[model samples]
Target: MKSGCQWRMMPKDFPPWQTVYDHFSRWNKAGVWECALDKLNERYRHSKKRAVPSYAIIDSQSVKTVYASEERGIDGGKKIKGRKRHIIVDTVGNLLHVSVHRANINDTKTGVAVFERAAEKYPSIKAFSGDAGYRGTAVTFVEERLKLKLNISTKIKDVFAVLPIRWLVERTFAWLNGFRRLAKYVEILTATAENMIRIAMVRLTLAKLP
Candidate 1:
């Protein structure tokens, strides 16, 4: 699946395509991928002499999905007809949480949903930073309800200037793009797509550690 090939087109050297796919589905349901990524994150953070992050950065990417995709919508601003991937990453750009949703969804709405989910998984997270897309009343809702600061980076007037904190999540998205499967939203099931992101981050995190 990481190869992003059709199940039937799996290499002959590999196990039967059906068997491989079934195992993958089972692992996703069993939370194997999530657990592995969590361990790798913990180990990597420790290796870097940092505790699990209390602050994170959140952002979303609009990705074009295949024709067969069911959970997709058009992102009018980007003019992309597909799904959006909302992700939160720690200070050093490690995955903290990921949410897949329709492209048409409002960034603030999606941010709320993803942040609520992240709050559950990462209770230590007390603050997060985002771009202008996530600004407005939603920032207050997160702070008052989730008790986490939603720091919105000031919109940069200079195109070349790097915005603090917000840029880290953008870099994390770039790292995810390195995985072929993530170049586009190829997974038919949203859960599978989320797992793929987790798997890619797991590999990247583990590789960073001794």
Candidate 2:
């Protein structure tokens, strides 16, 4: 994953490519990657002397998708034809939850599902920070449906200053770029794409543990 090499192109020093891919596919289907991420996130948070996070930063990224039969579409705002991923991260940048869908889907609609899943898993999260992209129905959905607050960070134009609370999730996406495989959506299914991201975070969180 770090090298982003194709499955069959994996170095022979490792196990057979099929063997490695099988284990990865099985784990993805079983939710092992997410479970490990949760356990390791808790451990890392405890090491930092933090409590279960009460707030998180939410953001979405639109990436170009491979020309395939995958469920991909154009993000009119970004003018990119691909899939969009919504990722939620804690204040310290640990990944909380992620979801992938067609780029044409509205952020508010996707944000609801992402927030719901994360809230169910981490009930302590009572609020979230996001940019103006989630303005209209997003804030309302969070308050009414999820019983959570969505704080839209003020957008400062003509300048590159970082928005403290919101940039953390953007940095997480930057970290993802380090993995070449993530440069584009290559998986045949969005569910697999989502798990592929979880797998990337699992590697990152594991490194921080020891």
Q: Give the top-scoring candidate (lDDT).
A: 2
- Which pairs clash (backbone N, Cα, C closer than 3 Å) in model 1? none
Candidate 2 scores a C-alpha RMSD against the true structure in Å of 1.3
TM-score, cand. 2 vs. native: 0.95
lDDT of 2 by residue, 78-174 (tens): 9999999999999867899999999999998778878888889899998998888888788888899898899999858768888877878888999
Q: What number of clashing residue pairs does each candidate have, in the order they appear? A: 0, 0
What is the C-alpha lDDT profile of model 1 across 1-210, one tens digit per residue? 256677899889999999998999999999999999888888888888887789989889999999888689999999999999999899977898898988998998778878888888988898888888898766977988988898888767867777877788888888888877888887888999999999888888877889
Give the lDDT of residue 4 in candidate 2: 73
Cα-based TM-score, every candidate: 0.94, 0.95
